[model samples]
Structures are given as C-alpha cells and as structure tokens.
Target: MSENRIYLASKSPRRKELLQQVGIAYEVLLLRDAPPRGPDVTEIVLPGEKPQAYVARVTQEKADMAWKVIQLRGLPQRPVLAADTTVVLGEQILGKPANRDAAIAMLSQLAGQTHQVLTSIAVRSALGLHTVTQCSDVSFAAMNQAEIAAYCDTSEPYDKAGGYGIQGAAARYIANIRGSYSGIMGLPIFETCQLLEAAGVRTTTDRSL
Candidate 1:
C-alpha cells in the first residue's frame, strides 16, 4: 500500500464516494465482513447516552476494531478511518428505519421540522486515535402523508439514517442546511481532510500546501 492510502472502516458507499471525490485513496476494511470471532461495533445507544456521546463512542470503537483487524490479518500498516452518522430530533436519536411503516413514521416526524445530523469520524494512526464530530442542521419542508408515504415506498430510505438520504429523493424535502453538506451525507470532507493530513496521508486538496 502506498503511504498516501489509508484503510476505510465503513461500508457506506457515500463515504467511499466522498473520499474518492477528494482524491483520498483508501482500501475498504469491511469491518462487518471480518471473521465471525472478530469484535463488532454495535450501534445500540446506551441508556442516558447523549447523541454526541453515542456517535463519538461508536466511531472510536469502529476505528479501534479496524486497527485490531489490521493486526490480525497482517495487512499493511496504515491509518484506519471510521465514522458513524445519526439523526437527532430533540433528545431522541433516529437510527435506520426497519421497514416501510417505520420509514414513513420517521419521515412524518421530520417533516416541517429542523433536526440535527451528527457525523463523528475517527482516524487511528501510529500516533494514536483521533476523532471529531460535525453537526449539521437540516430543515425539512412540510410534507403531506402522501408525499411521506411515496418516499417511504422508494428504496432510498431503508439504509440511511433518519430513514432518508439527503442526497437522494429526500433532497426535495430539505428546505435548508446550516452546516457541512457532506457531513449530512455521511462524511465531512473538511474535517476528514484535516484528520488524514494529521495522520501523514495526503489528499488532492493538499496539493496547494
């Protein structure tokens, strides 16, 4: 592996695309597909855990687990990058919806409301593990039952946080966004570049430096 490449510890295609967009070469670590005996990073929110805490903890665990996998598999030594995204309305954390009805309910609640999209990233390098969380405020237009149901009927809402993908059909419902758009998608490019640079990995954006 080249020194410019790192290990991406996520299965999200959005994350992969974001890295590719920035010319940050990475090899997918596929943590979930690792050996059955390997540790898995559970997304369960502990009792009384705040959204920020939960996201940060999960991101760190993912990076840690990826690092362990590297040692176990004898893969090349490189920085391990991991991230976790969650949608938060009030104090409640909205994770991926289980089914069509749940997706509809989540979209219904988010309609005409402003919610927070929290994406936490962790990078484990020779120096140690580093993490950062980016919070973006997304406001949705008022959506009618038919609109919500129609969106729920599509496959876009099933695998994404808050039961919607901001980059997909759900973009029509987004009224405004106050933070990093890439953060809302899954990875915050600015913060990700900062972490990768700190780990001695160069991105295309580093060319001007």
Candidate 2:
C-alpha cells in the first residue's frame, strides 16, 4: 500500500464519504470471506457497559477484526481504521432501530431533547493502535407525531444510530448542535486525521519536512 492509502474496515457509506471529503485515500478491506470469529465482533453491548465505553470497545474490536483480516488475506500491512457511533440519552444507549416502529419511538424520545452522539475511532498499524472519541450534543426541536411519521416514512433512519441521520432530512429537526458536525454524521474528520497521522499514514494535505 502506498503511504497515502490506508484500509477502512467499515462498510458505512457515510464514513467513506467523510474520508473522501478529507482527501484521505483508503481501500475497503474485504471481510465477507473472512472467517467468522465467534460473535459478530462489534455489536453486543455488555450489561452495564457505559455508552462511551461501549463505543470505544466496539471501535477497537472493529480495528482488531480488520487487522486479523489483513493477516489472514496477506494483504499489505497498511493502517486499518474503524469507527463506531452511538446515540445516548443519559445512560441509555440507542443503537440503530430494528424497524420503523422502533425508529419512530427513538425519534419521538429525542424530540425537544438534548442527546449525546459519541463516535469512537480506532486505527491499527505498524506504529501501534490509537483511538479517540468525539462526543457532540444535539438538540432537537419539538416534533409532532405527523412530522415524525413523515420522516420515518422516508426510510432514512433505519440504518443510522439514534434512528436519524444528521446530514439527511433530520437536519431540519435539529435546533442546535455543540461539537463536531462531522462526528454526528459518523466520523469526525479532524480526529480521524489526527489518528491517521499518528499511525504514520499520509494524507493528501500532509507536507513532508
């Protein structure tokens, strides 16, 4: 792999778009053929696991899984990056809704309330493992049943944490946000680049001294 290219272990289109926005070259690592190692490797939330800790743990697991895939496939040893994002209201962690009704319920609860969006990123490379988390507070305006139903009908919330995508139709529902907008979208570009640089991956904007 070239110095400018890394391996992205996630299958999220949002994460890929974020990386492209920052001009970071990356190749998607194939994990379909990779052996199933025990559990899903990144989805279970242990009992009493703090939201922050859960996201961090999941991100690390993703990176570790990607590393194993690299070794198993004999792929070039480039930095492998993975991330996990979660929505939290107090101690409750809201992951991707399982269905339309669940998405509606999650969105209704978030209406006119302030919640935390935590995104944790982990990168594994020859330099070692580096991880960082970005927490952003998002406040939503009061939403009515009609609005919620209409939004959910768009079918955009099913695959996203907290049952809504900040960069999608849900943007109109946001009254305020305090923190990285990109983080709310899935990946925080600033923190991602920081970890990438620390892992010795070069970006297009990096200048060699």
Candidate 3:
C-alpha cells in the first residue's frame, strides 16, 4: 500500500467506496469547502467536441481546479483525484438531466438502445498528474413511459450521467455491457488502479505492476 496519504477531491460516495474496495486509504475533500471557482462552472462540452474529448477535458479541468483549491487553502497537499462520466448516443452526448422533463426525454431515447458510457479519471500527485479514460458499451431494453417515470421518481437517475446508473435501480434496464462494468458505475477499477499506481498511489497489489 502507498505510504503516502491520499486526498480525494470528490464528493461521490461511489468513488470513495470503489477506492476502499481496492484497499486504497484516502481522505475526502469536498469542493464546497475548497473555495468557489468564481461560480458554478458549467462544464462546457465545447463546439463540436466528441464524447472522448469532453470526458477527458472535464476530468483534467476538475483535477486542475481542485489542485488550485488545494494551493489556495494550503490544504495538506496529497494526491488529488477527480473524475467525469458521460453517456454518448451516436454523436450526441447525453449528460445529466437538467430537469424532470429532460430526464423523461433522455430515458425515452435510451429505451431499447445501446449507448457508450465514457468515464475519465485524473490523478494529481507529487510525481505528476495522469488521466485515464474508460469506455463501456451498455444496452438497454425497451421501456415504457411508466417505467421511466417510476425510475425517475427515485434518486437513481437525477445525478448520474446518461440519466442512469448501472449499480442503481436502473440496473434492471441494462441488458448487456461490453466494457468495464465499474466504469459505467462511474470508475473503472482496472484503469483507475493503473492511473493511481502510475501517479505513485501505492496499493497492496504492488506486484501487479
């Protein structure tokens, strides 16, 4: 395991849980207390930005923003980890639903369709900063309006990108996936572990490298 302490720059419990699953000890650093970045920076997808580009850009932006926060606050400068997830349908990329109506529309479009889930994680440490992108192909069964409405009523889809979560109640809608299941859930263990290790975030499985 890494002898160095880790500072997680995210509020996602799933990421925390995933880190713990891999035996990586870390401390949480919420952005709320990390000072504001002027205002809520609407993560821009940019004009004609592809899903891969958007995902990687956001992940780096988040890590870079958090690094600035650490420097400004003089917080214990440990490795800062950040990530972003997106759902891509053909050339159109679907991010989090802006409202209930948007949620319904997104779910309807995703009904009985296969979409690409792209997750990017960036790790910043004393060694340097490294970013990794993981892609997953997820297929969903055709769903009715009632199904979409019922799922939307819960807390599952609102905060998740692509309007759904593979590990949440929305799991029932997924028929098959062709990539990292954990990536769809938000973080891919294989890629995340690799990035962390490269950034000098030590783990028990040192020999795996």
Candidate 4:
C-alpha cells in the first residue's frame, strides 16, 4: 500500500492531468451515476448565494460524498480529494454550458471583459475535511462574432465554464490572467497542495522530486 496515494473523487481529465503534473499519487474513485430524476443536483445555485460560497459548498459536498463512497466500498483508508471550479462575471456564476447556444451566450458575455475564476479544493480523511478556495482574474480580449462562431464550431466551449478554456484555442482570446493558471483549468495547484498537506497527504515537493 502506497502511503502517498489518495482517492480522487473527480472524473475530470484536467484534474487527473494536474495531479500527474504535480506528481501527486492518486486513484480515481468511481461514483455511481446519478439517476435522471434524482434530487441530488450539485449545481443548483441557491437564491442569493455568492459565487465563492457556492463553489466552496459544492466542493466540500463532493469531498464528503466521495468519502462516504470510500467507506461503502471498503476501499483502502486514504484521503479523498475533490474540487469544483466556476466562472463569475459580476454576480452571475457561469457553470458548464448545457448546449451550443448557451455556450455561445456565455462566451459572448465574457468577450472583452474580465471575470473571476473560483476553484475550491477539498480533502477528507480520518482527521476530518479540509478545503480551500482560490480566485483568479481572467481577461478576455474583444472577440467578434466570426471568432466566436469558429471557436464554438469546435465544441470546446461546451465542457468548460465561461464557455472557453484558457489552455485551449481560447488562449488567443485571453488578454491577461492574474492568478493560479491551474485554478482556471479546474484545480488550483497551490490551494490543492495546501489542502492535501493539511489532510496529511505527502506531496511531490515533500518527497523532494
């Protein structure tokens, strides 16, 4: 049993890649699919809930749920990590787009403006649950209808918050960024490292890699 391994509760490829990049040993925890009519929605922003609070709540909830799964499955006793990211423009929180039109609308609103990207990472262990939220400002250059249309054609916007990914073709559309780049990708490296460390998970740096 590797003492450095933790259970990751996210299915995000980006999160997996980020963990690998940081040399954090992790095992993906498979969650049962939610039924279509279930009331277990994780993205319903409460009335008057701020973006920061919403993301933090959701991330902790994910970590809590993942921990429960670990106990149920009798998986190896290890810390479980989960994260959530959202894009905020003013008071509105832009979540993952539901369709092409929605994606286009999101990108359109984000064009020529700066928005906040909030990523909350949570880790649960026998000691308890620990969490951190990191915020970053991303500025998008003014984009025309043609540019938006062409980018939307690739369907990259559909899976990302704010309808654009800073690491992808949308990179050309970004004018500036003032925070952790990994936070925009889904997991904020610094904040994630802090949470993992607090949960007693040794990081790559601790191993002197």
Candidate 5:
C-alpha cells in the first residue's frame, strides 16, 4: 500500500466519489459473508438505541471488521474508513425504504417538515478507532400525494435513507439544509480529511502543504 493510500470499507458509490473528489487515494475493502452467512456489521438498531448511537456503532463495527479482514488476509496495514448515514424524523430512524410503498410513506412523513440527517464516520488505525459524527438539518418543501408517489416511483428513493437522495431528483424537493452537505451525502469531506490526516494518511491537501 502506498503511504498516502488507505482502505474504504463502504459500498456506497457516493462515498467513493466524495473521497475521489477530495483526492483521497483509497482501495475499496468489500466486506462480505464467508461461511457465517451473516454480515460482519449488523445494521439492526438495538432496543432503544438512539439514532446517533446506532449510526456511530455501525460505523465503528464496519471499520473494525475491515481491520480484521486485512489481518485475516495478510494484506498491508493501513487505516480502514467506514461510515453510516441515517435520517431521523423526531425519534424515529428512517433507514433505506424497503419498497415503493414504504418509500412513499417515508416521504409523506418528511414532507413539509424538517428532519436530521446523521452521518457517522469511523477509521481504524494502528493507534485505535477514531470517529466523528456529522448532523445536518434538512427541510423539505410541501409535497402532495401525487408528487410523493411520483418521486417514489423513481429508482433514487429505494436505495437512500429518508426515501430520498439530496443530490438526485429529490434535490428539488429539499427546501434548505444547514450543515455539511457532503455529510448528508454519506461522507463529510472536512471531517474525513481531519481523521485521515490524524491517522497519517496523506491527501491532496497534504501534497499542497
């Protein structure tokens, strides 16, 4: 592994794009079930687990698992980065919609309301696990049933939290956002750079420095 390169333990193309946009060289570390037939990181929220805690825990588990994978495979040692994002409507955590109906329902609840998008990132390094969480408040414009249903019919909502993607067609429906937009997209560039730098992983900014 190059001194500047690290491992990204996420399947989200958005995360990859964000890392690339910031000139962070990373190889994707795909975590898959071996003989266990289960995921390394269970995304299920524990009983009464707060949204913040849930996201943070999941992200940490991912990074930890990625580190273990490196050791198991005898791969070069490097920082493993992972992240999880969720949408919160009050106390409820809105994960990825299961189907079109579910997507419609989630969008209906979010219409004409403000919700919080929480993204937690964790990196496992030789020192230990370093983590950070970014929360962004997003307000949605009022959407009628027809509009909601039409939007849900598209392919964007099913794969994203809160039944929508801020950078997709759903962007038009967003009234405002307060906080890191990249965080809402699943990776906050500023915070990610901080963690990576702290872990001694060089980025484009480091080259300029």
Candidate 6:
C-alpha cells in the first residue's frame, strides 16, 4: 500500500479512533457538505429494499461519493473508505432522532427490547470497491425517563444510530451484545479490517510511512 493511499471517507471520531487503534494511517474524505449522517431520509428505498439492501445501497453510495470527491479534486488516486450503521427493531429501521421528543420516544420504545445493529463498511480502490456488513443483536434493559433524559442530555446518543451508544453512558442500558461490539459503536473492527486488507490498505508501519 502506498503511504498516502488510505482515505477514511468519514469524520466520525469513533471510526477514526478504530482505524488508528489498528495503526492504519488515513486521511479524511468528507462525503458531502453536510456530514454523512444516518439513512438518507430523502432516498426512497425501492419497493423490495430490505434492511440489508437499504444499508448496502447507502454504504456503497457513500463510498462512491468519496471516490467522486477524490476524482473531482484531482488528487493522486488512492483507496477511500466509507461506512453506514443502522439500528433496527424487527421491521422498523431507526435512524437518529429528529428532535428531543422523538429521541425520548425512540428510547422509550427500545427499553426492555432487543434490536439489531447493522454496520456496513465500504472501500473504493482502483481495482473496485469492497464492502462488508456486520450485524449484532443488542438487548437493552428497561429504562425510565430519568435514565433516558440523563443519557440524552449529553451528546452521546444524538449523533449515534438507534439514539444510543454502546461505548458511552448508554452502555448502562445495554443488557448484553451478541455480535461485534465495535459494529454497534459504528464500525466493525474485524469487517473493516477485511475491507481494508482486501483493498490493500495495510496497517503495518512499514507501509504507513
């Protein structure tokens, strides 16, 4: 891998920290003027767009957008990475809350229920784009208004999918997790490594420098 060929198409601190934790040196590739948040509210998933399909579509779109940015900027070609995460309760897909009231309602609905966290990561290289989607089932213990309000008052849940973060104070509400913990946090470490490795995004210091 070239020293400057790795680009993270996101500004997510969690995603950045995860990549850095594994010693992967990368530059940020912002997808759009506004940060790439949850599901594109305006994107109408086709009639048969299942959760997995919807997520894959968005993930690929984000990765492709980053690639377009790099191309438009006329920077030396390199690999760009992008990802999307969604929280689902049965057939209902939950995105970031629209407001405090919506957040409270989502939290209320999630209390004492189990939901699936799906995180998909994509990488675009000269060869082609690679992607991986990981799913983890998380169970949340019952939460009261006090607990929800306390967690919501902070910035932890607002930006995260499902309106809660597994690594933050919201951890208190999670009874247990059955998949990649990092996935719930936004990026699946194992799957992300797979995508990077496949795209030749090496983590060895030998390559980073």
Scanning candidate 5 in windows of ten residues, the lowest lDDT window is 31-40
lDDT of 4 by residue, 108-196 (tens): 99999999999999899998989889999999999998998889888688888888888899999899999999999999988888888
What is the TM-score (0 to 1) of candidate 5?
A: 0.95
What's each prediction's TM-score? 0.96, 0.94, 0.90, 0.93, 0.95, 0.89
State the local distance difference test value for candidate 6: 0.82
List RMSD in Å for every model shown. 1.5, 1.7, 2.5, 2.6, 1.8, 3.6
Clash pairs, candidate 3, are none
lDDT of 6 by residue, 13-106 (tens): 9999988887877888665544433233234467867888888888898888777777777767888888888989997888888778778888
lDDT of 1 at 72: 81
Candidate number that wins on lDDT, 3 or 5: 5
lDDT of 5 by residue, 23-79 (tens): 888899877845322346789999999999999999998888888888777779999
Q: What ranges in model 1 sit over 4 Å off?
A: 34-37, 205-209
Clash pairs detected, candidate 6: none
Q: For candidate 2, lDDT tens digit of each residue in 13-78?
A: 999999998888889976665464322574888988899999999999888878878887777899
The candidate 2 region of ten consecutive residues with least summed lDDT is 33-42
Q: Count the backbone clashes (under 3 Å) in each candidate.
A: 0, 0, 0, 0, 0, 0
lDDT of 5 at 59: 91
lDDT assessment of candidate 3: 0.83
Off by over 4 Å in 5: 33-39, 206-208
Q: Estimate the overall C-alpha local distance difference test score of candidate 2.
A: 0.90
What are the lDDT scores of the predictions, listed in order? 0.92, 0.90, 0.83, 0.87, 0.90, 0.82
Q: Quote the positional error of residue 200 for candidate 5 in Å.
A: 0.5
